[model samples]
Target: MERREFLAALPAAAVGLSLTETAKAQTEAEPFPGFQPPGVDRWERSDVEAGDRPVGASFGTRSEVFGRSGAAGTSHPLATLAGIDILRKGGSAVDAAIAINACLGFLEPTACGIGGDGYAMLWDPKAAKVVGISGSGRSPRSLTLEAVRSRLRNGFIPPYGALPVSVPGTVDMWWTLHGKYGKLKWAELFEPAIAYAEGGVPVPAVVAYYIRRGMTNFARPGMGIEELDNARATFAPGGETPGVGEIFRNPDLARTYRMIAEGGRDAFYEGDIARAIDAYFKRIGGWLSYADLAAHQSKWTQPYSTDYRGVRVHAIGENTQGLATLQMLNILEHFDLKGAGFQSPLSIHLQAEAKRLAYEDRARYYADPDLVDVPADWLVSKAYAAQRAKLIRPDRINDKIRPGDAPSRGDTTYFSVADRDGMMVSMIQSNFRGMGSGLVADGLGFMFQDRGQLFTTVDGHPNIYAPGKRPFQTIIPGFATKGDQPWLSFGVMGGDMQPQGQAQIIINRTDYGLDAQAAGDSPRWHHEGSSQAMGEDDPTLGPRGLLRLETGVPDRTAAALAAMGWKIGESDGGFGRYQCVERRMDGNERVYGASSEMRADGLALAY
Candidate 1:
């Protein structure tokens, strides 16, 4: 069959297989036919001391892990361990993912929680197909563009507060995904999170840093003082944020988990917990109501993909900027990324230009599919990408860029799990803008997400705030398949840095032949475009055009980019943290490679 024909047949072939049959077939055949082994030159020595700790040695660096039975990688070590434990107990990839997400809510509340939203891509080995889950929440039924504009300070929504609160969708998403793909009981999934929340888990260094940062920002004058007090009461407790290694407990969250465990999703969406959330929002001047919560339902949509060098990359459609990642990848595929060299000025410049073009389209047309018509298919088409790639000039930065005529279109914790049963899951959950909208429900032990703040008040805009509309989302989970079977599951978390990271990771693994860990750890470049009306800006961002490169990028490459009329600077965080699990078959034996973000306090574990 022709490549296009095979691409067209993938969905049907994947959906028709069953878990047992898929695994059996994989064992009988050579899984990755054209696979290339990792090159010897790709391995490098770590700068951090590995032996007994000496003075000035870095304490956080670690190595990637490999396994044959099961593997899991997440942003937190405890979450990774919890997922591995679930896998050991005969759980499916979805079950392990749910367990990991539950643990992350308590352990890394700054990134995700039941009070936020989530998305996932599940690879059904037997059926040989991928399934996408849109766990995003809708705006409050009462939220209107007029009401939003009336409250805007300068035609832009506040980063936090009641105006940004959307209906909590993470719990509903959890229940929905569990009902469809989970092997363990619903209540069993919450046990790890509940125990940790009630029995105090030590604050990891990264978690401690974010908690302190939150306290400082929230306590600043002119900020939300009442919300800060609630946050302090729950996270600080002793008049200060907890330090690294210090025990922190959230009894309220524990109770919330128990209630949900007992009554299923309704416990949070319709019962006493829901009542508490409604009361808290009402008192705080937010629009979320019981009706919003009651009406919320997670959608099981068909996953979308674009083929790059024979590998198909999949991401959730609509209400997400995920398709933009594929668009960027499609554009990048038109060039020889590996031939240009990793982190080379030519490589970085092309990627930045492609991303800028894709984002322009995103800002103009991407939004909730139910609310507006998005040319999803046309956006990722190679012909469209080729046309967009033409706008990328090799000699200089393109400043006159605008959305193409053909079609407009287009953070948070991300983790991946692959069980021994051949099931793999790539999932991301988030409370937009770390720690979310500061409004901690009176006794819920978690803060609500500020996702609604992303919506614009511009009349007729696709992402304009509206009743029951899902605002454009940044948190996305990514998956890739070779020959219509699970090959890679990964995600990179951080606002606009996500799609950039996704494109780079795919290039590093597929083109440069790097393993999962190296692909994640390699120097990253964040394309900082002009700040949108509702966006935040930093010194590193400007209209002159900026490409924030992580420390690992060569100074020469930075100089080259600068000579091309692009402002280049070093970035502190926003580069994004990545985690991935790649499944490779050696004959009939299934091998798993897992990676955790080097910038994070986590490790990849397999058994």
Candidate 2:
């Protein structure tokens, strides 16, 4: 069939077409100028880290673990160990996760703490399906859009300060998760974290780096912060972020956790903690109040999914950008990526283009479902993706692509936990943008999330700021099932990188036949300059954005992409940090494999 004829025959919403490899190859747009060498990959070099690998290891690989009872993959080794300890004590995955998350507050507080919002996806063996929850908080009841608009200095919410602070939801989410899926007492879960908080643990390299960076940014002028004394006194007490291996303690946090342990979730939301937060914000002239904290509630959400190569990928729906992953997967499902080869120029181009296309819709549709009527069903449907996929020309980038009448917009910590009984959890929590708003409530020991900064100030946008509204969130956790069985629990941490990085994980495992560790270990590509759903007017973003490749990607691929109208650049470690746990039945026993990102101070352990 001719190029036009091939596309014509495919139905607008059909899926699982058995297109041949040769036919798929023909779909590639003729290379721009047809002269750039297909840039070859630099897979191995003696000067770099690798020396030897296990028989089944993938590139830049580490030892992936397998276990029959349980596994935990966390950004911090200490946090991972805490989770394992919880599992050993007969805790469920949710229980282990609560423990791990609590530990991360002290160990990796630059990314997560109780003051942040949280989102999660889980596989409940008893229910035999995936479950999801949205722990995002509402803007203060008294803070109107006019109030927010009057406060914007740069015509957008700044990354740090009380202006962007929202009533945190992580504490409530923890109780919710525990109430539904936990097998251990809630107070017991915080025991490990509380002890560690009081005793002090040595700061790791990655957290230390973010601390220095976050403290510097928080201290910068014009960040909308009325006070920096609290933050400086809380985190950088010595006038700087703690150095790696330096012992760090948060006795304030310890006392706070102790209160939560005794008072339940109410301790944070309805009790003394909330009062303290309310008082601090009032003192600082911020919006949040005790009424806002007391009124906060996080809801359970039905996760959205897409079929990709026989696996069902699941993520939290709107109010978050998670659905964009499903949409991207839907578009890429049309191509014979397996034939193009893993990490090849053609494959990378296809992924990048798919991201650009889906994100256009992201800028148009994703919003709080309670307030906006997002066509969630149509957005991720195979039909919508099939129609959208046709816009791409094999050789050229589609700069004119716009939203298909659709819409959305952190830094975050993502972790995975699985227990012996088959329950699995994918959890991501964050304070947003380098250690959150620069306000730490008196004696509470955690910074309020800067997530409100993600709300676009564009007039009449669905995601515009409003009292009692949830801002468009940046963190998402994901789960996947294969052949109706719990398959994978995974997530990637970084604002905007979560969805794309996750899509690549599925593609790597299914299309490229990579094992769990290698799927995460392989070099990745990240795209920059997507439309910010800002209703236009902002000048920096262009029609087609820049494509950034990791160090291991070949120059040939970059050359090929540039020839095809892509502007290529190198990465600044923003690709994302991934963690995952995969389950498979080996003969009669169920076994699990865990993988953690090499880019962060993370670890994957099984037992």
Candidate 3:
């Protein structure tokens, strides 16, 4: 039978001991003999076949001597530890970020890379202010909407199509941030990354999971074995993608790193990398040019923020869905969330209502303010939040949640850093989809981002395609302050679910009084409509399901919520990891990080 029919035949019950036993028995007894699951539905790899198990190994190191020290939020403990090493060697936050980012490129290439884009929230403790860097890239100038539409009419959605390809700005943004705020020499920051890229870095469990799931997505015409092989020439002998715990290297990427280390942004924008990118674009009939690559630059903007209770919440400004997080917080501010307890139905219902409302506003108004006007002030206003709240029925989810008409705005990775000197950085970067457009340039050792696909094809849409204008984005890193004091540095990574997860993190920290890891590891209810893939993963997801709660939640809450008219579904709450560095008003810092144990392949460590 086909995968869909097989999934439809699976059980539809909440996660319980009974369900687990049944699933296990089915596996052992060879039940559903003809059934085959979709590739996306098979989230389990050899390592993470079962939930609630210890994930990959955890390791970290740190020093508090005060000349310089940095803490990172990254998937692999070794990568985070490497950043700390850079800090111990007198590297700044920017320096550590560059190091950790390059290491992630090596281990988690399916998540992000040198060919992607990044956005950063930098805090200069001495300056007592923050700098926002927009690392998002613009669409190729030559790929007009009309041209793309014509291609679509020809029954061709071009591989790394005109709609998805964008000028890469990650390297540019890295150099820009380092040039402004780094204490260590740029060449020194490149050491760990170059070593990892050239020598090899072991693949982590989660990174391996992404590769397997994204394999089919990576098999497009221009992004097949030939491309991955050419890109991995310097790293893998015959260009073989490494399995979990296997050593994978990218000497080509190391050379690319050295180019930037030696000549700053010029090495990438006007040199060999530029020529390589242009040549690839020309070969693919894409519109990106040397001029676009040379002209692309990172932007410095003020972070938009709102007061949630006593804590000041900051998110990326106008063009991003960062403000939507503030909107969610604003709506939740009017409710007594904690009074309902952690997993109570009342608590879940109230939060889901707030999420549905905020996302509606996000769909209507959030976009690039330079190209389309986003009413930021109105959307984030207390009155508007109150008005939106009135639409919630309290006991039931408003599934008819519509995207409000306003103005505007990823396998993504996020990691937060805090130094001994009070400098805190909340950074996020991604290639959009897993390994992004999946088109690795010949010798660049990286995949391009599919950011342009984020733009809507519809005319007059707030996020519609436009030249030199950024597409609506979801990679938001969060920075928060309490009455001018740096309170926390945090972020969560999961495509469209990012802002919702951010709001969940904030509420857990602020209202629920949970620390960073506790907040991240706690049960989460994502209200991003019912995902067909999610429904197939578990038997419990019915057609009307709007809320996907974790198995850890109390049965009383599920029954109560069902009676309250919620189409609730159960899940294992996979790899919901978050890293946070919190500081008190007394200047003492508590660096805390936690990842989901439910992730059969997750690890959270601190030093």
Candidate 4:
């Protein structure tokens, strides 16, 4: 058959298989780009030293766990262990997840706190379905566009800017998920996060890096550095950033978490903590109001899924660009992309164009569905994919492509849990940026999420700042299945690069036939336009290229992509790390995890 005819027959052929089957078949015939190890991954150890302080070193000793089959769970070690314990004791995946998340709020305070947002995707084998939960918050009504503009006019961005000052929705989301799917009480979930917080969970290396970085940004008066100091009385009484190996504690955060455990979500939304938060915003010129807290809620929605080869690709819908990942998959499905092989010039060019194309649609149309007329169907149509595919030239670079649809946007962490009962949870949580808004309610101890700062005040923009609107967010979770069979539960964290990373991971596994870690470790690339909106640290960061081979990618592939009109940037490979778990067909299951060695401290655990 001619190439086109052969390609034409593929869809019909693929329609008969599940994503897993198609991916396996493709891998059997042509291997995807496997890692070209520069040296043994240096940071593969279960434990390691990190940070400038002793507390950082103590964090290195923690372990992360991955498991498969009967039941498995993975997250930061403390959270993972907590979830695993819950599952072992008869908790459902949702139950374990809530427990793990609550623990992370205590142990991983630098990335998330009670004052943030969460998003989740779940797959249930018994029902053969997927469900979404949006725990993100809305902006305070009192903080209207004009109110935000005044702050900008005063020569201040709302802490990261007014965009992130929205109401926090994470607790509401947790309570909602637990109420519907949880087998354990919401109070049970709060145990770990509270004990870790009050008892002084030792600071991890990554936490220390952000703590020091946050201190630099939060030191201004009225900005809430004093709250951190007050919260850290047990952990860092001397005012010095806790060093590696030191015990770090937060009695205040512990007390706050305990109130939630006993009082439920209402503790934060209606009680003293709420008052402290409202008072803090008032004093600091922030826009959040008591009504915003009273109005907060987490919503449940349907997820968008597409068949890539044989495996089902599922993601959160429109309030986020999680579907953009699916749109990219849909576009690439039209071509026999695997025939190009990974790392070849033609392959690199095609992937880059696919990303550019998808992002174009993202910038032009994606936003909170309630607030905008996003052409969701049109954006992912096969016809649109084919049209976008034409923009890629087999021989040249397409750097001039502009953002057509994206309206503009995390210590967010992801953990996937599956219990023996067959309940699956794909959960992600965050404070928005590292250390969040840097404002802690006086006695609350936890930092607020700067999530609101993601909105713009510009008139007519889809994601413009408004009274009670949710901002563009980075924290999203994904779930997938093959027909009625549970396939995989996963998520990746990074700011604007998240959906891009999700697409890359799925493409690597489904199209390229790589395991999760390999897909994660392989050289990766993201379009430059998205990176530019993130401000000076990101925009002026430098020239970016397609196929950034992790420090582990073979030099040959790096050279190949560079030769293909791509500017290659080499790094220590520590910036991007992913945690993933898979349930294989062999009746036995496995959890495989990896962290970027490029990061001074990252650990992947499995048993």
Candidate with better lDDT, 2 vs 3: 2
What count of clashes does model 2 give? 12
By lDDT, the better pick of 1 and 2 is 2
* Ten contiguous residues with the weakest lDDT in model 4: 55-64
Model 2: per-residue Cα lDDT over 1-607, one tens digit each: 5967766665543324456644444455332232334432123342354556857644756867999999999999999999999999999999999999999998898899999999999998888989999999988888888888887766777667777888899999999999988899889999999999999999987888888888888767666678888778778877877887899989999999999988988988889998898888889888899899899888998899989989999989859989899999999999999998777888998898899898887877777888878888889999999999998777778878888864332578999999999999999999977688878888888888888887877776778788888888878998899988999999988887888999999999899888888888888898877755442223364777778888777777888889999988767788889999999898989998999989889999999
Among these predicted structures, which one has the highest TM-score?
2
**Candidate 2 structure, TM-score to reference:** 0.90
In candidate 3, residue 142 scores what lDDT?
Answer: 78
Q: Rank the candidates by lDDT, best first.
A: 2, 1, 3, 4
Our model 3 lands, by Cα RMSD against the true structure, at: 8.5
lDDT of 1 by residue, 1-607 (tens): 6966854655444434787765555556545333335433122333323354332212324456889989999999989999998999888889999999999999998898988999999888777799888888999998777888888865677777888888878888888888878899888888999989999988888888888887677777765434556777988897978887899999999999999999999988889998998887788777889999999999999988999999999988768889889999999888888889877999988889888888877777778999889888888788999888888889898877877675333148989999988888999999988888887888889988889878888877778888898988988898999997789999999987888899899988898877677788788899776533324334245544577887667779989999999987657677999999989889999999898997777778988
In model 1, pairs of residues that clash are 14-127, 14-128, 14-129, 17-126, 17-127, 18-126, 19-126
TM-score of each: 0.88, 0.90, 0.82, 0.80
Estimate candidate 2's alpha-carbon lDDT, on a 0 to 1 scale: 0.85
Which is superior by lDDT, 1 or 4?
1
Whole-model lDDT per candidate: 0.83, 0.85, 0.69, 0.66
Once model 4 is optimally superposed onto the true structure by TM-score, how far is the C-alpha of residue 288 displaced, in angstroms?
1.4
Q: Rank the candidates by TM-score, best first.
A: 2, 1, 3, 4
Q: After superposition, how far is residue 198 of candidate 4 from its true place, in Å?
A: 2.7
